[model samples]
Target: MNNQHKPLQNGLHVVVVGAGIGGLACAIACRRANPPLPVTVVERAPEILTIGAGIHIPPNACRVVSSLGLLDKLKQAGGYQVKGFTLRRYQNGNVLVEKPMGMRMKTEYGAEWLAIHRGDYQGVLLEAAREAGADILTNAEVIGIAEGIGESFGKHMVVLKDGKSLVADVVVGADGLWSGVRELVLGRSFPPVETGDLAYRGTFTREHLKSFKNERIDQLMEAENVQVWLGPGRHAVFYPLRNKTEYNLVLLVGDDLPEGVRTSQGSLEEMAANFEGWDPILNTIISCLKSALKWKLLHFKELDQWTKGVIALLGDASHPTLPYQGQGAAMAVEDGAILALLLSRLQNQGISDVPDQRNQQLSDLLLLYQDLRKRRTEVNVAGAVDTRHYYHLSDGDEQICRDKELASLPDSAWQGPCSFNWGDAEYQKSLLGFDGLADAERTFDEWSRKKSRQANI
Candidate 1:
């Protein structure tokens, strides 16, 4: 065994398992910190493969990635701007509402929403991590993790299936929803629980969509927008991708949820059948699919503790969000950015310290990450859940009521938060500040001192 932290070079030696978009992005983000850290990404699969379908990265996430200097690479790997999203009735394709993206979002939030293939995004992130000096190892499955002892003991030692072991100061579980590291940290198997909804996803070439270029489909294909077709117990979304060369389709069905489907894989046929009476374009998209992967929507209700000892969970491992708001991966990306930032701050405090001081620093850093993220993640998670309910509303009087509520906004109202009179610039600046770690430490110290003084009093 490499008994010393010598090769670790006085910097952090991190082991990030999974190598998915979240894992790879975390590695890349860590490398982008003010002072770069050495990172190792371990994946069970021999090699990464593109699977499933497209993913929508909202403005909030795009902004984080931009901060990491990956805009060019992101675009290169199938990143495309979405003009907006339109809500429609599947029967006659009547437009109920339209949400414009891109410039409108950029103007409002200082970033643009991007849509790209899941595999494509993962490829970009992995490549970026490699270029940034992150060591990525494939087919290195971590079967178990045990805590270490003493200062510079590197927190946890991961044992692989092949009997190989890796010790690291930080062991980040970016391994998605069914994370082994999470199971270890939580001391139990907290598998993902279904959210009573399943999704069908597929992608179509522009050529396949040529005949369907009416106003609704045209807006869907030409406009970088997400077009939703709502129906009874189901909803479908179509959006342009990769400069309009392809169109992404997703169908969310509420009833008849499959018993044993992981959120990652659901029956596309069931998803399609739920939308049987919907728009012809949707039906066409369904027919074009050789097979639709199943996606059982899952949410993280528990797993309150995101860290234990020196091991922590990032992205979906810590908090898995439903896909309703299309910000699942966006949230994960944000988690990566925030965690990397906090870890960087910790490393800045000098790695060569006493055991007690090191533990205190580590705890302070983690508490800060949780404090800054918990509320925001909870907000996004609630939004995702609410959005899912909104999309799956059964068509009828209730559906009409929901639609009216959404479209009730008057024309006088601004299209986005940007047009609102709120002080968005100042808000953005405040959010951009990187003082969470300091705040956490001060809060802890103040609380500790206060408790002591109160006892004396």
Candidate 2:
């Protein structure tokens, strides 16, 4: 298995479990490869439906979306181009930091920042995957995975709850946070850890906001920007969607929810109580919320490995993170893109006649995928954790220092003692301007050369 050799089309079949953002992106990326690989995505739900409320797709992810030719579709689906973010004081609604994102993002990162409804984003990816020749099987709940099975020498078996099974050359566990495939890969369950925080999320249309009859609320409904208010043990984020026709809001608060109770019907009174004494604008937004669902915020522990034999995990299955930095979906999108690049490279290295060699080649490729993705994903996970602390700081000298640093504005290029930097453009670029596909290709080349030298020695 070398870069110089091209793998013959031995009819490799890839089965991806789960049809969320990560799973759908993986299927699309694989099928769109130069010499496209056969892909089938199995989703447990009776029908594909969006579970979350909204998602912020920063430039890092926007680049991938553009490369896949779905940016236009995303925009057409009511994706709002975010101008920038405004961080305001919780008590007074005074601006602390104004980080411009629209033109600045494109000029520096080569892609626009987009705020979109989660369902619309998923629909775009699903449509693209199907158009790229990937088969999608709905209501096909994968109950378990069995490796080293099948008469045609299949490497893995995906057992379904419906008593049907699918055998494939590779099994992708994109099933998300409570992934059964991940448990199978690790030989035990490692549930995500609770972060002592819960979020109430909802979306509101412009017409709905107009009912409030408040001028400030009306302005927010018309503006194309993301707004954040930080308070002790709490924070709120709201942004427009679908050409400013709608707005999405997320309210995070310290909670005492019992273990294993993740989702419940959230009460407006409870949500408002958490923001007591806060700016009136946030209250208005809260008033406009027609409905909301509250869920505990949980994070996954870094895994020792993301792949076992011929099975691999992606997205939330591998590294589920808090939404503090808004990079959870971005990381998953990058994972799928890079994984596809590596697999496509493997396809170019013609298959071996010996079964052992073929298996070893596939294993090596999986290892490379893990090696390329592990460090970045871990950094993002840690960054999100750091953001959680910074965003929830109580009133004190530390909070004062954070506000001072933020007050320095877009002109100051300095890093303070705070855990997160809200105004630094360079820091933002490091996270937002990353090119995952390019990085993967570069790393693969380096890895191949190193192995080549070792073989000669």
lDDT of all predictions? 0.71, 0.82
Best by lDDT: 2
lDDT tens digits by residue: candidate 1, 1-457: 5532222655777788889877887898888876898898889998888665789877777887887788888898878887766788878678776655568767766677788888778878877899999988889898988756554363557778877777677778888888888898889988888777776777878887777555645555667667778776677877766777877777777635457656444455755677677777667666656565666777668567888777778778888887767767876777777778667766874554565556656765676666667776676676667666666667678777666655643352433233111112343333322233344446545644664598599
- How many collisions between residues are there in candidate 1? 7
Tens-place lDDT digits, model 2, residues 351-455: 665667777778888989998888888988888888878888899999898887777765553332333644556666678888989988888888778867987
Residue 164, candidate 1: Cα error in Å is 1.4
RMSD of each: 4.8, 4.2
Candidate 2 lDDT score at position 62: 89
Error of 2 at 19 (Å): 0.4
Per-model TM-score on C-alpha atoms: 0.86, 0.94
